[model samples]
Target: MKDVIFDDFQNTVSESLIRHKSILDIITKLQESNARINRAIVKSVTNCGCIEVNAKKQNTLENTNMDIESLKTCLSTQVKGTLCDNCRDVIQNEIGNNLFYLTSLCNALDLNLYDILLKEYDKINTLGKYSFR
Candidate 1:
């Protein structure tokens, strides 16, 4: 076994861009990545059924209230960092809920998650302080 490190994630992402790529391709790729991460989190918890059920629940609910703001609220209230393993599980559940909502929002909006992320980076690079608002 050997130790290896990749110091530049941004550079790797930038270099992966190809010509004539459609926005749907980017969104599909992101959706796939999120699915994989969601699976890994579920596996780590030793309770795949729990996360699977959460995903179903998220899909059924009409989301008039969901965002990063809601995630922060849940994390602060339900899963304070000072707690033990049982409490940390609650935090993981909250995060899973947020992830489901965010992914669903992307799907509903027909927005390419990766393209949106790239545009945000471009804004930061070009507009700097103006992007803050």
Candidate 2:
């Protein structure tokens, strides 16, 4: 069911992508979109003051018997507040642009966005906590 949405979005991007047809263009635009997303998030913290970054090293070893699962509870995103309506909207739009360019890049490479998502999903599910490290 959700796959239908991804397929539709990918198809739409493939059809709508007129200017940035080259893979290099698509990749650079994707990177720009990523930068916009980061900027939006930072603005939410700095300009709007809707959120605050309470960043610090995680005290994972406060308890000698702490396991991996226990560490999860102690870990923080370091974010201390929720996004206000304006920041949320700006961030969502930036993310949407990023996805559009990402889908465009996939189309240029003759790849299926949904399939890539499924493969990544399977890998994460299979690896669980060890998927990244």
Task: List TM-score per model, in order.
Answer: 0.30, 0.92
Question: What digit string (tens of lDDT, one per residue) describes model 2 on residues 1-133?
Answer: 9999999999999899998999999999999999999999999999999999999888876798977787777888899999999999999999999999999999999999999999999999999887635
For 31-125, candidate 1 gives per-residue lDDT tens digits of: 76567666655454455333222222233135557565564444322211233465457557656544444444454465455566668778899
TM-score of model number 1: 0.30
Clashing pairs in 2: none
**lDDT of model 1, residue 39:** 61
**Candidate 1, which segments miss by more than 4 Å at Cα?**
1-83, 121-133
CA shift of 37, model 1, Å? 19
Whose lDDT is greatest here? Answer: 2
Best by TM-score: 2
Model 2 accuracy (lDDT, Cα) = 0.93
lDDT of 1 at 89: 74
